[model samples]
Target: MSKSLLLLFVAVFCINCSSDNKESDTPPTEEPLYFPPLTGTTWKTKSVESLDWNKAAVQPLLDYLKLKNTKGFIILVNGQIVMENYFNGHDAATNWYWASAGKTLTSAMTGIAQQENLININNKVSQYIGTGWTSTPIDKENLITCKNLLTMTSGLNDATDDVTPSALTYTADAGTRWAYHNVYVKLQDVVAAASRQTWSAYFNTKLRDKIGMDGSWFASGNNSVYYSTTRSMARFGLLMYNKGKWNDDVILNESYFNEATNTSQNINLGYGYLWWLNGKASYHLPQSQASFQGSIIPTGPNDMFMALGKNDQKIYIVPSKKMVVIRMGEAADNVNLALSDFDKTLWTKISALYQ
Candidate 1:
């Protein structure tokens, strides 16, 4: 072997080795988010330090919530509890009302029912619930569909205080209007009739039992409301954070879950089927005719969508951060049935804590 030939061969080998080293040094991709299994009363947990969070900063956020009538609060990252708090004698065992936050649960169950081929959301409400479900005549009632109920676009006159069929009169075609009305209760009935089971029974079977959630739905006059422990609410937020999955089980359909959390109608960019979404150009507050000019929760994550309810029940999900936060308690501010200024203040405090 000549010296020149050997030197050239050595340089070629060196080049190949450098290329291989570069390929192996590329950074590994981040781990995909995961959820805990639905098993015993205890759920998996993670420390704030696991995410490099400043623990000292969390106390101010807690103190603020305590002063603002909050009873229960939980924040989960990657489906593990990072913070679970209760105030005013409310503890892990206390079951509280989800208020309109339960609307998100109903929407999920509706999606599951549709997934099971029980009833299509786009189908007319009269089809499953039978005719005369609404005060509207045959022609008008035919225009009102299950989707309308879900989207709060049923076009029924929400001006009336009474919830009867006659009081829930039709003033316009379905899908043409968005009003936060108690007429949403009819959706549960529609699901019930279509599934041949009561709303509570179906929900208990399809969702609660499947997710190890111990919650009960009870009648509150014209509405059916849900009551559950703060952890149960956190479990629900986790199920949604994983995009409708409970560990290995696919409890809610993926495609349906996406639509359920994103904007569902042109009228309200921050409202999905029944959930409240954040990071939209604008949003509408319940019982208000005006559409505000910003995300419902300005300080929360841009990707966070929420289940906000009357007198301040909340379930917040941030897919970008693999986070699910829940607030189940009394009113933080004198707001009606939707997002409030307190949402901004609390989230702003939380943002500081995570820094």
Candidate 2:
């Protein structure tokens, strides 16, 4: 072959290789996060086919949810509803109780109060509500901080759900032990005292209203449970998925949000600031002192975190997938609080959709 012709052929090959490299180096465009309107029933949705998800797997998931007694179920991707279903006489307009999952709401509100200088989580709980709030001795009680309460490491007894002074007996030194106790509700009183506003009022002005969430705290026995439509719970999960931001608004600082989702203490690696974390090396359960080895949900994404409640209410947020899943209704199987066998089975089914 002629030298000039050979040189031209080599030049063409080099150009083609360079173009291929450029295409491979460029990052894929990500979908922008969506925020639904503040009012009306309107919400943006994406079809499973559009996302290239397993359409065949979708029905099985819905069937399992209904069979397990889920009244409302929603799956959001980048804040857009992808799958929503209602079962057993429930609909989008129906409100369901959040049970212990409502603890995440209190955690977020506490962070807001701290950012406004109304309270500091590191400070003793007694500092805001004054002493004698618990039956623990003065020095022992003083050792408990709002942060400890948020992490469920207040070392308080979990024998009773009651938070009255007479019932809040001590179990161990603050921060030295971890137990899932309803004593975290005292953080509500702390915020109320510090901000000089009722817990609901402060929550409305700072978090709920700002995010366009529709919900109200109601008295259930000794606990202040939150009841909201399924979509409202998804809204809160979306906010957390974005690290406490709604559109351009900074509702809670990113730093606090990170702390609230990650492990808050060494004792329970699977728990955060009222949030249940997955992918941890070890974890502790609601009423058990035994430390179990392995992630909270092995089938779930490593970055997933959850707001789990009594009777199977769940808000599962997976940052790796930019997905927020919500489920509300009675117990899926046997009546239980927070984590259950349902989680493992549910994730196994959910993994099929995106795997």
Candidate 3:
């Protein structure tokens, strides 16, 4: 070959190598999160094929949900709907009760109240509501802080749902015991007293309206339960999944959000500020003092946190997967206050979709 032709060939090979290097070095862009408008029925969605998820697993999961009497079920990925279904005479507009899953809502409201300087969670409950709130002796009663109520460490009786002063008798000194009780509802009273606004009023203005959720708290016997459309529950989960942010708005601060979703007390590693955490070493159940070993849901992602309610209403948030799952319905099998065998089995079905 001529010298000029040999030199020309070498130059072309180097240029080709350089081009390939540049292409490989560039990072892949992440998909942006989708946030639905604050006042609209329209919501964006992605299909199973687009996500490269197991399309074959979708029907089986839906079948199981219907068999177990699910009223509504939704799964979101990056704030977009991936799956949504309603069963047993329920529809998109049908409202269902959140049961104990609503406790997480109260937790978020308390955090907001603290951020607003209306109340400090560290302060004694009696400070806002005044003394004699509980029948416990003055010294013991003062030991109960707003944080205790959030953590279920109030050390109050869990036997009765009644929060009347007489029924809120002391089982042990506050902070030393962990028993789920209706006493957490008192935090609403504390917020109302401090903010000088009705609990529902404050909740509506600060949270519901901000996130475009439509829900109302109602008095059922001695409990205050929140009822809302399944999509509304998904919205709340999306906010929490974003670490208390809604698009451009900072709803709940990140500091409080981290504390609320992690271990809040020593007794139950799986229990947070009314949130049930997965992948904890151990956990305690409502009305039971014994500790159960292992993660709350073995098949669930380790990083997932949940708002689980009586009869299996749930809002599951998985940060690692950028996913939010909502389930609202009657008991899957047997009546349960919170965690049940259904959780493990349901997670197994959920895992099939992405695994």
Candidate 4:
């Protein structure tokens, strides 16, 4: 090649090299999502001004929460309590039932049980909980797996009020139907049977104590309910916000954590393992078989996932916003088994705060 041709090639090569170098020199794009220190009640906070939020927009949220009968409301920004309030005679030390939101905790404990190899979620429920755990025929009952319970696809009839295995009447085959059922609590039994420890003992040792969370499970008639201070609920949200890691301790395996938060089945795009997910194209409401279009909490950040419960109890984790928010109280407007209008309305007010 001629010297002129060689020079031309060299110029082109240099340009390409410069382009590659420029791309490489670009800084990492992820926002600084902060996590608080492990093993302490003391958590550092970031102010609205510091975080560039519209400071004046927060008061409206408090008023709305109060009007909606919210007992405890908390907002943890980057692992700190940016806002905390209690109303209706409720205080910080008060223990409130998580209701269905505690299902998320059950989901986490199931994942932990799987992580220890004490049980496999894919195994038949009968394998651990034993046959006749459901009223279905021997063969149909065998089809139910822990995964089905996690995904609320147990195929067990949920129209009835009974929550026991005998009352878990069969409808469709497992993995074929998705119906929100307390059959998820059966997971506690599975973990217990597999680990040879009661669900409360197993969960306390594996997660609660390890993360410095204060809570306990109590029998609520046919089902058990978890009660804890609002702050303790916030701590669990932060734990999940950090993907099951507390400082250096890996309380839950990251892979399982992802599975628990992401869409677990095709039936409900707005649901994970016992968690309500935002940004999905469609969602399903409890006690309803209809599938609705659009995100569950449309006003909230797209990446938010929540442990939502009856009477509007909520533990919302927004990864995109680096926040954990919780609300515990009586029914907001209406008594329901799970998510209500309060979710969207409250989030709309919250979005205004960030505006």
The candidate that wins on TM-score is: 3
lDDT of 4 by residue, 1-355 (tens): 9999999999999999999999999998954545555456676666778778888888898899999999999898877778899999999889999999999999999999999999999999889977887778999998888999999998989886577767989899999888888778888899999999988999999999887788799998667899999988988998999999876689999999999999999988888988889999998888778999998877888899999888889999998777899999999986576777788899989888787
The segments of candidate 4 whose C-alpha lies over 4 angstroms from its true place after superposition are 1-41
Model 3, span 1-355: residue lDDT tens? 9999999999999999999999999998999999899998999999999999999999999999999999999999999999999999999999999999999999999999999999999999999999998888999999999999999999888899899999999898889999988889999999999999999999999999999999799999878999999999999999999999999899999999999999998999999999999999999988799999999899999999999999999999999999999999998987676889899999999999999
Worst lDDT 10-window in candidate 1: 31-40
Give all TM-scores, in the order shown: 0.91, 0.93, 0.97, 0.89
lDDT of 3 at 101: 96
Q: Which candidate ranks first by lDDT, i.e. highest? A: 3
* lDDT by residue for model 1 (24-88), tens: 99988875565556666676778888889988888899999999899999988887788889998
lDDT of each: 0.86, 0.94, 0.95, 0.88
- Candidate 2's error at 126, in angstroms? 0.9
Q: To one decimal, what is the Cα RMSD in angstroms of model 4 from the true structure?
A: 6.5
Pitting candidate 1 against candidate 4, the one with the higher lDDT is 4
Worst 10-residue stretch by lDDT in candidate 4?
Answer: 30-39
Return the lDDT, model 4, position 85.
Answer: 91
